[model samples]
Target: MTATILLTPAVEERAPCTLPPRLVLAPGETTPVLIDGAWWPRSRDLTAELPALIEILDPLWGRITRVTVNPTFWPVIPRKVPVRGHVVHVGWFEAEQDPHKLLLLSYTVGRWDLLVIPPETEPAIAARLMATATDPSRSLTATGLIHEAERFRITAEEAVGSDSLREAVWDSEGGNDARRPASHASAGAVIDHVPSPAEGR
Candidate 1:
């Protein structure tokens, strides 16, 4: 969609701030970023590497507030009843990239969304996030790159089942339930005997 940038007070005061970076969308408008560079594909590897990535980027930027990775359901209609399926593992990092503004790095599985918001731009944050997910590279900065690594981790984790679910499944199979039998028949046998939708009538 449209390019969006958010600048917090910390970033707004900085001289490095340029024309707010446009969210890269069109085929020919993409920024040249090395996606496969430095960062690992696995979440664990990325998590392990985050500290270093932040350290390397911090001096170039300003101060990093926090890096957060969580599942988020972005509602197309804010007040709608039946919201759509969620876009999982929407990763974010809030950093003071400049003295007068805040740099927000928002990313998901497909793309990165960057925003440079002035201290007073809090209300427009959601719109800015949506824009960043469309294209993250246009806002490429030292802080943004650090966040990309974490976003990659979040994406990788979403691909697999959650630890809690995995543990429950594993524990059930390893415990007494592992020996339990079906009340009727095995799944394969049940499938073989299933009636067609038409036959049920």
Candidate 2:
């Protein structure tokens, strides 16, 4: 009997593609808000990241002419970045701009402020922060939203730790430890007292 051997082809590694910007905008209202929306970027590289953001916002908010960021968060800031066929000017400020916020200026639309969620944030925590930041009813600023996110993350970790400890205790004794009451902590407690938007300014 003759056995046939088949050679397997090696799969080629592909370059990583950019993800769509994780952005959420607040409901439009007559009154201006401290923050217009929130953007969660995948990296700190402003040059590499700005094009995708501009492409998404250009049509909805008008042609974005200028964008500004704080030097603290972004490592390298290019003077100008080309998006589509036009050039978008990039500016950086230390004292004037908030580290957690990005300011965008458009040709048709006036100015827009967005909460810049950190690149390394957990998905759950980032989602909560994005929702809160864009909430029209909430007067929290970009900084305030970040503070709230941190608090929420810490609380959630504590809750998980507590749950594990309880499970360990139950395991040590019998599985049917009916006498012990179940304890649950709420993560929403931190979001209840969001600071006024003015605090961030």
Candidate 3:
């Protein structure tokens, strides 16, 4: 199935916030927000909290064609491949009217995917499907968790190396120096305690 993946920067709980005024639920209008790629609460009170979240995530949602909430994942039993993959399911809702869709929130895992539905009612249906999602935590044995943690460490190291290379290239291309500025006098200073050959003789 076709899906769009959106990556959000790490969420900081202490960051400032802003949101829109809560909307009265119309007969056919619905909004939902996904928290860590999962459906979050979508009551009138919860929707009212969207404005503050919207402020923090203003940069991210600007490019989004639409926002969705109550995302679900279904594990695909591999037929030919030995590994299983998860399919993302989502409910589409109007970002403006749905406070759930506008909240700037963070996830434990650093990434989230929003599935924009062409039809608004799709989200409500997706929410039901999401209720059946298998808890990823439950699937991971202790050993699996350990292995995954180790893999993450290795990935982080590789990322650091990649960043260093990029920085070096940028510096070569006259990019801003990341190092602290050095004083001219300090750079030019020299030691002067030499003796002539004749004096030594």
Candidate 4:
């Protein structure tokens, strides 16, 4: 019997993600910033990540808008760095109920969301969120993040302009839809180098 040799196909390396110009930070910056519903990854901690992030999103959060982070941000190591604005009155929603995990910023500039999706599924879920933030007409029941989102939410008072976002995952009934089950008990955002009150502005 003669045996035939088979060639194996080499796996191609994924290209570097081309982030939007605005999303690109200076020499050093932390990332995985959930911008306009898209996620941008960075390789380092930034000197002024928040200001730079807000600057890129100026059209949405504006220069002087009051931005509040969930209390979960405080009480962490490094002794509680300060933010541009104060913390919200009501505490954060349980992980089983928060709308977004990257950041729970409360801004009054306006509800703004933009999405540019590639062929990947995770990005598409993020894009769908951005799309839903600005437009309530779109339903997110079909989006990939709904199952995870169903278990995380903010308070009624802190959930301004997020009614649609809260409802998008209602269909999940707090259970997995199709993807692998997600870990839900991780701590909230840990944005390093966020300028202290005196250091910033």
Identify the candidate with maximal lDDT.
2
Over 156-186, each residue of candidate 3 has an lDDT whose tens digit, in order, gives: 6866776676555455444555353444224
lDDT of 1 by residue, 73-115 (tens): 1111111111012111213322312211122232322322222
lDDT of 3 at 135: 32
- Candidates in order have lDDT scores of 0.31, 0.76, 0.31, 0.32
| Models sorted by lDDT, best on top | 2, 4, 1, 3
Question: Under the 3 Å rule for N, CA and C atoms, how many clashes does model 3 have?
Answer: 9
Q: What are the models' TM-scores?
A: 0.20, 0.76, 0.21, 0.28
Error of 2 at 156 (Å): 0.8
List candidate 1 segments past 4 Å from native.
Answer: 1-42, 71-201
Model 2, range 1-201, lDDT digits (tens) per residue?
Answer: 111221222111212227888899988763688998999999877666888898999998999999988888777666777677787888877788888999999978799999999999999998898888877677887888899889988878966776676555544444555454444223333334433335535
Report clash pairs, candidate 3.
Answer: 17-52, 18-51, 18-52, 19-50, 19-51, 19-52, 20-51, 53-104, 91-123
lDDT of 2 at 16: 21
TM-score of 3: 0.21
Output the lDDT of residue 117, model 2.
Answer: 96
TM-score of decoy 2:
0.76
lDDT of 4 at 82: 24
* Residue ranges of candidate 3 with Cα displaced over 4 Å: 1-137, 177-201
Q: Among all windows of ten consecutive residues in candidate 2, which has the lowest summed lDDT?
A: 3-12
Better of 1 and 2 by TM-score: 2
